[model samples]
Target: MKHLFTPYTLKSLELKNRVVMPPMCQYAVSSKDGIVNDWHYNHYVSRAIGGAGLIIIEMTDVEPNGRTTDFDLGLWSDDQIAPLKRIIDACHQYGAKVGIQIAHAGRKAEDADIPVAPSAIPYDENSKMPHALTTEETKEMVEKFRLAAERAIKAGVDTIELHAAHGYLIHQFQSAFTNKRTDEYGRDLALFGKQVIRAVKGVMPAQMPLIVRISAREYVDGGYGIDESIAFSKEYKDAGVDLIHVSSGGEGPILAHGKPGTHAAYQVPLARDIKQALKVPVIAVGRLDEPVLANSVIGNEEADLVAVGRGMLRNPYWALEAATALGKETEIPGVYGAGFSLKK
Candidate 1:
C-alpha cells in the first residue's frame, strides 16, 4: 500500500515522498519590502534538510496592497525574483521541491489603506470596508495573478499553487456571503477563480502542474459546503488546475449550525469526496500531525499527499521523526546520522 514516505509525481514535479510542508505565513518580512531574508531562508531550508518532499512558500501577494500585512511577501516587481530564487535553490539542494502560493488578501488585507474586493463589504463588523472592484479593475487583478506566476517560474519553482482559499481575494469572489455584486463575477461564483487558473496556466510550462487550494467547507451559515465546492472545483479543474488542496473554514466566524469537528483527520473525508467526485488528486490537510494517521490517509487512498502544517512548524525535522516512527528508510544527512541511529 502507498504510504506517506512513498515517492510521487505529477507532470514535471517529482517528490521523494508524499510528505508536504504546506504554506504557513511567518509574517517575518523585515523592511516591509516583501523580499525574503535570513528568517525565511532558515525556516524553509531547515524543513528541506529535515526531509520534507515539498515545501510551499507562504501566501505571496500580487501587489503591495494585496498583502494581508505589510510584512507579507509580494511578487509585484522584478526585483523580488532573485531573493526568492535564492531560497528555492537552497531548498532544492536539500532535496525538497518548492512551490509558492500566489494570492491577494482583498477584504482581508489588514494593512492596506483601503482593501479591494468583489463587493463593497467589510470582512466583519470591526473590519474596514473594502472598495468594490469595477469590471475592468477585476480583469486587471487577473493580470496581476498572471504576472506573479511568471515571476515564480523565473524563481525556479517546480509548481505553483493559487491561494483561492482562506477568505482571500478568490474566496471573497466565490462566496455569496461576501460577494454581493451583480456583475459577471457574481453571476458565476467560480468565474474569477477559473480566470485566475487559466491566467496562471498561460505563463507556466505545460509540464508544470498547477495546484489550487480551496476551502472545501465554509463553517458559517450562508457559506458554501462540500457540494458547492465540488461544483466550483469542477470548473477550476476544467480551467487547467491539476490538483486540489483541500482545506476548510476561513470565510467568517464559525456558526453553531455549521461548526466543524475538531478531531484529527476531520478534513480527510472532504479531500476524499473531492478526489472521487472530480477524478483528480488532492492534498489533505488540517490537524493531521500524527505520522501513523498521516500514513493511513495515503495507505487508504484517501488523499494522494499529506500536509502537516502545525506539526512541521513545531519540529523542523518532523519528516525525519516520522520516518523513524513508521520504520521507513529515509535519507538522513550524515552530519545528523548519530541522532537517528538506534543504540543496540
Candidate 2:
C-alpha cells in the first residue's frame, strides 16, 4: 500500500488510509438554528469520496452561545443530529471514516449574549470581554461536551474530537495569559485542559475513539507554547485521549508564524514531540499540500496522520490527484458522480 494509503487504527476504528481532512470552517450554516444544511453534507462528502481516510468536520459548537461565528455548526441539540448523520452516513458509504470536532468557542463567540471563559478576559483589545463562568456554569459546560459527544455518536461519526486549541474558550483556560482567576478552574494553568479531557471521558464510550485538537504554541508572550502543549498531551494520554491533533494557535494575522517556517509540514514537530513523549498517535497538519511532503512525514515517522485543510479545500479531488502522483487511480465522491463520467 502507498504510505498515504496505509491503514491507521485509532482506539476502535481503523482508518482505510492516512489522509485526513482536517476540521475547516466553511461558514455555511446560518445562526438561525443548529441544523447543518446540504452545503455541509456536499462539502464533506466530496472529500470523503475523493478518498480521504478521515474527514473531521469543522468545530460543531456544543451550545448556540458557544459558537465562534453566526454560521458555525452545532451539535448542542437533537435537531442538528440528522444533518450530521447524513454527512457521516455519506462518508461511511464511500468507505471513509468521519469524525466531528466539537467545541465551545468561549470568548471567541462573536456578539454573544453570554460570553464565557474560565476568567473574564478580552479575546482581544477590540474584542468584547467575556463573562467569567460560574462554578455551576463550568460544570454545565462539561456536560455540554458530554451531550455533544452523545449527539455525535447518534449521528454515526466514527470518532469525536475535542477542540481545546485555538485561542477559544478551552485555550483561554489553558493559557496563563488568558486565565487569571483565583478559583479552582483558574488556580492551575492546566485546569481548563483537564476539564475538556474529563468532558471527553464522560461522554464518549470506551469503544469510541477520542481525539483532542490543541494549539501546540500560542506564539504570544506568556501564552501556551509547544512545551506546555506537550505536557498537556501527556496529561491527556493519561486521561485516555486516542489522538492529538496538533494545530497552532488561532492567533489572527498579527502573529502568524510557525516553529520552523510556513513551508509544508511546518507544524509537524508539535505532533512529533508530543508523540515521542506521550507514546500515542499524533496528527500533523498545516500547509501540507504536496504528496511527497505528506509521504515524508509518515514514512520517516515524523507523525502518524496528516491533516490537509486548504489544500483539500481548493481541490476536493486532491487526495485522488495525490494518489495518482504516487501511481494510483482516483475516485471522486458520487455527488459529483456525473462530473467524473469519463473516469467511470
Candidate 3:
C-alpha cells in the first residue's frame, strides 16, 4: 500500500511522493501583461527546493478577460512562454514535476469591464452583471484553451490542469445553479468541460496526464452536490480526463450561507467518493495541512494524492518537514543536505 511519502505514477509522470501543491492564484502580475515576474519564479522554485512532489502553478488564464484579475498569470501569448519555462526547468532539477492550471474566470472575472458566463447571471447581487456568451464565442473559447495548452507544452510542463471549479468559466457551464442557458450547452451541462478536455488533450502529448478540478458539492440551495458531480466526473473521464482534483463551493457566495463545513480535510470525503464512484486517480485538497492527516488519507487509500495549500504557503519546506515528522526517508537536495540530515 502507498503512503504519503511513497512515489506515485500517473501516465508518464512519476512523482517523488504523493504531495501536491495545488494551484493558488498569486495575482502578482503587474502592468496587466499576464507575464511571470521574479515573484513567480522564486515562489515556485522554493517549493521544489522544499520538496513538493508536484508543484502546480496558479490559475493561468487563457485570455486577458478570462483572468480573475488583471494581475493573474496568462499563457495566451508566445512571449509568456520563456519565464514559465524557467520555473518548470528549475523544479525538474530538484525532482519535482510542475503543472499549470489553465482556467477562464467567466462571470467571476473581477477585472473585466463586464465578465462573460454561460448566461448573463451575476455572481451575486453586488457583483457586476456579465454578458452571456454566444454559441460562436463559446466555440472560440474552446480554441483558446487548446492554444493555451500548446503554449504550456512549449513551456515544458509535465501536466496540465483544467480549472472547472470555484464558479469559473467552465464551472459556470457545468452547474445548473448558475447556468440558465437556453442553448445546447445549457441542455448538456458537461459539454463545455468535455470539449475543453478534448481540446486540451489534442495539444498535449498522449503520455501527459490532464487533470480537471471540479466542485464536487455546492453550498447554495440550488447548487450541485456529490451525486451530480459524480455523474459529470464520469462524463469527463470518458472525455479524456485522467485525474480529478476534488474541491467544493465557489459557485456563489453560498459557502457564507450554505451547508459545507470548513474543518481539516473537510473535502476528503468528496475526493474519496469520486474515486470510489469513478475508479479514477484523484488528488484530495482542502485543509490537508497537518502531516498526520495528509498521511492518513494516503494510508487509508482515501486519496491517491494530498494537496497542502495554506500549510504550504506558510512554509515552503512543508514536504521536508512532513518527511521528518513521519520518519520517512526522503532526499533533501545536496545544497540543503546538511540542513535536513538526521545525523545533525
- lDDT (Cα atoms) of all candidates against the true structure: 0.94, 0.81, 0.93
Task: Give per-candidate clash totals.
Answer: 0, 1, 0
Per-residue accuracy of model 2 over 62-92 as CA lDDT, tens digit each:
8888987778888878988887888899889
Model 2 scores a TM of 0.92
The C-alpha stretches of model 2 lying farther than 4 A from their native spots are 251-261, 328-344
Model 1: residue 336 alpha-carbon error in angstroms: 1.1
Estimate candidate 3's alpha-carbon lDDT, on a 0 to 1 scale: 0.93
Worst ten in a row by lDDT for model 2 = 251-260
Q: Rank all candidate structures by their lDDT, best first, as comma-separated numbers.
A: 1, 3, 2
Using TM-score as the measure, which candidate wins? 1
TM-score ranking, high to low: 1, 3, 2
lDDT of 3 by residue, 1-344 (tens): 67999999999889999999999999898779899999998999999999999999999999999999999999999999998999899989999999999999999899899899999889999889999999999999999999999999999999999998988999999999988888889899999999999999998999999999999998888888899999999999999999999998898875445356557888999999999999999999998899989999999999999999999999999999999888788899867857774422
For model 1, give the RMSD to the true fold. Answer: 1.4
